[model samples]
Target chain A: MEQKSNKSLWWVVGLVVVVIAIYFAATGSPNPSSVAGKTVKIGFVAPLSGDAAVLGQEMQKIALYRVKQINEAAGENGTKFEVVYEDGKCAGNDAVNAFQKLTSIDGVKFIIGGLCSSETMSMAPLADQSQVLVLSPGSSNPKIEGIGKYTLSLSYSDKKTGEDLAKALSSYKKVAVITEQNEYNIGIRDTFLEDIKNYPSVSVVANETFPKGTSDFRSTLEKVRQASPDAVLLNPNPGVTAENLIRQLAEMKAWTGYKLFGQLAYLLDSGRAPAGNFTEGMIVIDAPNVNSPELLAIEEAINKDQGGTLNDLGHYYTASTLDAVDLITSLITKDGNDAEKVLNDLSRGRFKGHIGDIAFDGHNFVRITLSGKYLIQNGKAVLQSEQ
Target chain B: MVQILIYSFVMGTQVLLLALALFLVYSVSKVQNFALGAIGAGIAYALYFSISAHLQIVWTILLTIGVSVVLGIINFLLNERLTRKQEHLFALLTSFSFAIVLESLISIVFGTDGKNIIPGILPVYEFGVFQIPIPGLITICFGVMIAVLLFFFVHFTPWGRMLRAIAENSFSAESSGVDSKKVRFLVYIVGSFIAGAIGILAGLNTALTPTMGFQLIIMAFIAFLVGGVSDIRGTVIASYLVVLIPETIIGSLEGVSLNWKMVLVFAVASILLGLRPNGLFVRESRKS
Candidate 1:
């Protein structure tokens, strides 16, 4: 009786181990849905509620609109494209959580967005480990390019934006620089300084670094005003610094003859400063505007379909998401359920996108023209003459 | 130097808020309420929404405090139910879980996007080389006021003495006809409310993000650990010292990244914790 019981127990344990092994084998790897008739899931992650929520919501809206349009135009193998929204919150740990959730719960074949660079940085390692394809819509940090073979950025580097700004301001003799001391701001400042080194005629009159979320600018502005440069280049986000700095500059009567230039950080439309008049005559280097004929058509169609106009920043995210969907669909059509094949196809081809043309180099870095300088005139941002 | 001082003060205010919450709960319940961070974050979210909807700051602050009180009461009741006969570890786990739930709830409601409280800058007051913002000054004032009130309540009030008794020996206080459970609930509510109000102040000073509370909580924990978790004065002083040391050093370290400073802080804290397990100001055990 004891021998029989021992044999029965061994058999049960063996059966359980086999079942567990089978489960792990079936679920551990990335498996594409039925390529013939099932709905294709495209995952999107963004900061939807914290300090960056406004931008994230805008991105989500645009992405959803684009997915709707894609599904309407060409049903992928008689299947519709569905977007699964994941909240990244633009933080490291949160981005990882969102990535895991999307990969596990939604079973997304392709993913778009990881809006902030920090978030992209955090998700990159996991994406590589999971063999998941991720295309960042607005992650411009140079560090992201080295993350993995599957990660790609639609946005250009800070270096490119800085170079564009330097070219735009080549005619100016003296320039003052004010930048926040955060990574993003520092990246732009360092790039701008490096690029400006090439211009012998321009002198950096004053340079000041302030903390991120700094609420007051009078002292910094006073220091900059004392230097009395022909132009002031600020690398802080437009939220508080731009509004207050501009207002203070106007109050100090420093805006009369001086030109103000900023990076894409000053592109937010707070509706407080209408037409960027306080910022008028200001030059900024940013992602290409969605005001072109093709973009306008797409925006119009999106608004008609979604019942609202996409914000300026939202358009870029929308374009990136659409491009990502197109790339993924094309890949899956060519080779079903093979992550390697999909990655190879994405790396090998050049795709035309709403933002511009996109082609990945041998290093898996997507080469895209995302740097352009625009002039803020009478509260409107117009492409610079050179651009 | 002035900028660093101002930033330090602002950072100190957040630290004090967290320290005070920890102090209050530890003094009355003999259990550290780790949910202080969640309370603060929830209040911040409430304040942000209220301000965005065109409500006055005063009213927003009031609403935030109210929400925090509600959360604290719920936490107390739930903790009481779960930890009635369990070990201290159970209470700690329960509070930790509560914090997670609150954080996740905020995430679900607010979405993952970080919202800036207000996008405009406060005008700076310049006094030669000494420059500061009116908002930063207000935060300092708020911190001081809360600390003063807390001091008076703990030292002068009869209820405070009863709370002290309960913290010293819950069974003895209960045998003396004091309702230890009620005192625990009151302490939690008051502590959480203070944390919540400070959260609003923090949101005003910087930007409001869901995870902003996480950093502040760590700083607060450090302050509590350094100052002696049982002593309010010690905690407050430790909070300011912790913030000031880092700010002063980081300001002096030109071209050395902030990440290096954070690493240094962690290393120092690990050493300090090793040397002084009960913190700088160890509380005397009455029964012993």
Candidate 2:
């Protein structure tokens, strides 16, 4: 019995030693929690392996490019940066886990990430309590504005987009709205409904909402088809869910001579391509048009690191990511590593970015780059210069 | 009304194919076969990869079927011992864990994005006011043919009798010299093949995601439960009911959306089961 106990004790000790070794090996650093002077460790949370990974991955590449430029400008003896990446999977639970790991385990005071609104919203309460400065590159939900004092977004809110969409749709006599029950979608939805009241001639024929992860929309589509609306607004989040919605809607070859309006989902070719020509001439309401030759050149240059498919979605997100890196790093450089102080100065600071000018109002959302409308032509949402 | 029927049947046939696979596996193993969903998803990835590789159509079909057989064998190996020992709860857990493992592995290999089997707009067949895509038509014909053939096999053939006998009483059937192990293995392989074929068709009809199998299997589970687990024909009826009830209710109602669809389906199924506990087609005798 004594010998058996001894053997089990040795096994436990061996397992612990192996776990410690793996911890050191995986982190690939000497004491990951400790950052030497002149080196800034920033935590990055993004959907590196889910339906929305394309967007997150592109933001990551742009972020890395910006970091490289900053570090090179800083020189070898100057303040260098290291980013610790965690996969948020575009879900709330996973984002919370990533945030906890980055804050508690990796010991990061600054986090740049969580491109999806769901990811950013989930990590807000924790960041507020922990005093970790979280700067989201592209989370656009209006609810994100007041979520936390420490949390801030480079992307503009969906509130402006919602009103912009209503104004664009004011000419239509009838409109049907189909929205996904998600934070970002709901933000736009509530605002759009409220603003649609301004258009007395435009009446909503059918108002529908579906839960997330719902792939089959045959019944919803059929019912929407029956409503005989002049315009149908497809409001699903960008990813597999959006693709599924448009694909199913296309499969039911009934909607002809009807206008299709969407948000981020239809604005990206990857999300709308599954619907084929069915989405042609559709109008997409999303971030402002940042398709200048200068922006396009930067987009192509940054996307080269990601096999050049990163811009398949759009270039506005790239601009936002560059501005986020610039804003956060500059704040940290001017102000010390104090997260609260950095966050405070960040709200007041304004700088020129790829999207032109960047500034934040009392609300944490960036006040620059209002939403724009695009007309889908030849399977792409071209910027409607008129809008 | 005709349009609703067309839509329901188009969706129903795919669910029927999935439910039939579930029923076939349950008839032999006496387990819920939760892994059926992941297996379908794995095969979907296989088809996507094959298409991406630009393989010949015949080779792609054969490779997909071949992957299905291999997946079936792996599933059988994972659960065979527990099932033989009659540890059904453990076997069910094993199958469930297998599903998780397969889903995680696929997500790691292929990522969780949706992929299209046929990337362009599919041609639609118009019957008056109803429009059914080519894939939907193929699913209907193939699903109906498979269902009829399976019905004949389960009701008329000797192998199906062995399956029924084993399902009814495995020990007794084994004592009567029935090789229950071989029959179960064969059933699992066949069931997986059916799942893989149906998975390809379903992906072609819509889009392929790692979680699609779980969504499909849920409908199949509801169908098989509402009908009779032991009766395939009953499952067929229940499949259509599960889809049509919600489709009809949500379609006709002015304010109702698709969110209420699952609620309406469950309510109707509960009411149906309350009336006929044995199932829609199952006729159980009550002894005085």
Q: What lDDT tens digits, residue by residue, belong to model 1 across residues A11-64?
A: 999999999899989877444534655567778887775545666777787777
RMSD per model, one decimal: 11.0, 11.3
- Output DockQ, candidate 2: 0.42
lDDT of 2 by residue, B227-249 (tens): 98888888989998988878888
Off by over 4 Å in 2: A1-36, A252-254, A292-294, B283-288
What's the lDDT for all of these models?
A: 0.71, 0.84
Interface RMSD of each: 6.5, 1.9
Native contacts recovered, in order, as a fraction for each? 0.17, 0.68
lDDT of 1 by residue, B1-288 (tens): 565667577778878878898888877655667888888888889878887888887887678777887888888876775444645677777787888888888878876444556555444556665555555677888898989888888779998789778777788999999998788888888877888877777766555656667677777888888777666777887788777676666555544333344555666567656666666666444575
